[model samples]
Target: MSKVVLITGGSSGIGKSVGEFLTQKDFIVYGTSRNPENYKNSKFSILQLDVKKNDTIKKAVNAIIASEGKLDVLINNAGAGITGPIEEIPESEIKANFDTNFFGPINVIKAVLPQMRKQQSGLIINITSIAGYMGLPYRGVYSASKGALELLTEAFRMELKGFNVSMTNVAPGDFATNIAAGRYHAPLIDDSPYIKPYGDTLKLMDKHVDSGSNPKLMAETIYKIINAKNPKGHYKVGEFMQKFSIVLKRILPDKIYEKLLMNHYKL
Candidate 1:
């Protein structure tokens, strides 16, 4: 029997590409979107899901479990982004960011674990980001959210080891996607103090994204992770600098690392 797979945020970008990749490999694949109807053009079936809403998440997971008897793989690729100075960002926006990026995957994870635990076999792949390794200049909240997920994945791996479930966190840096277009940017009033800096930072962020690696590369990485008998706890995907940043962050001193990030972002 083919493995059953569920992917979140499959309407576009890495999720969509990964969903298609898994489908091509003959997995029983299902993708989720907030407005699944928008995904009508997609070849795979789309489930209406909002990671922030437990009812929607439970319903979606239940529907899959009922049909397949079990879920083999879950790709927690759903995330939201926000950019601006921490002081300037409203509490509501920051909470919204965490809700979609952190708590959202949580609901799905909690709902799916029971079924996976009973079977004593399953794989959970979380699509984190390089920023999660270190806070970015403007996208600090987004980084925090991804950082939380990465740490959560680490802890869960130890807990799930008793069962047969495995966890993998893939951190892709600046992938070419529509994410930047929709990312929440802190409002800039005329009297705002950080307007100039915010504009410059936003430009640099866009430049990195516009020139980022293709989403299909990430899809391929996910496929490799799924097929590997024993994948590592974390995998970094992106350009040389992006991948290097992770290793450098670990080895470099605090001041040097902070300076490096500032220089890179032109801060």
Candidate 2:
């Protein structure tokens, strides 16, 4: 029997690539997109799903469960980016960011756990970011959302031990993806009061992404981790700087890491 995989935000970028790769490996993949009708892929079936909408999430899950009998893998790859300083970012934007990046995955996890528990086998992979490990200017809220997910991965891993389930968090650095293009910028930033003070920080982050690593690399890495019999708790992908970030976070003092980030952001 072919294993079943469900991927959120599977219409493009890493999610799309992962979905295709998994399909080639013989997994019956159901990939979700908000406007799934607009996208088509021969490798996997696309379903409409808006992670932030409860009705959509419920419907998508139910349809998949009904069709597949059980889900063998759940990939929470749906996420949006919110750029600009956290202080001036509107409350609604902050909530929206958290809703998609954090709560969205939580809802999927909740919906899938019961089926996985009954089967006594499943894997959950979360596409978090290096931002989850280290904070940067203008990306505070994005970092916080992923950071919350990082913790959830840890907690759920320990708690789900007896259930024969596994959790993996992929913290890749900047990748060639639409995440930056999809980032929600506040309206009238030119008219906003905080624009001048933080304008440089936004530019710096955008520049890094423009020269980021290839998304295919991330897809390949995900495949390796997914197939591994005993995957690590977290896998770091991207440029070596991402690996350096983890080491720096561990060995360097807070002030030093803060200075490093500030310098990189040109703040």
Number of the predicted model whose lDDT against the real structure is largest: 1
- The C-alpha RMSD in Å for every predicted model, in order, reads 0.9, 1.6
Clashing pairs in 1: none
Summed over model 2, clashes come to 0
lDDT of 1 by residue, 1-267 (tens): 999999999889899999998889899999999999877889788999999999999999999999989999999988887999899999999999999999998889999999999999999999999999998887899999999999999999999999999998999998889999889988776788878888888998898899889899998999999899988999999999888988898899999999998887677
* Candidate 2 deviant stretches above 4 angstroms: 187-193
Off by over 4 Å in 1: none
Error of 1 at 221 (Å): 0.6
Q: Could you estimate the TM-score for every candidate?
A: 0.98, 0.95
Q: Best candidate per TM-score, number? A: 1
Please, what are the lDDT tens digits per residue for candidate 2 over residues 1-267? 888999999989889888888888888999999998788644689999999888898898889889989988999999999987677789999999999999999999988898899999999999999998877677889999999999999999999999999998999898877777899875537777777757766676677788888888887887888789977899889899777888999999999999988777666
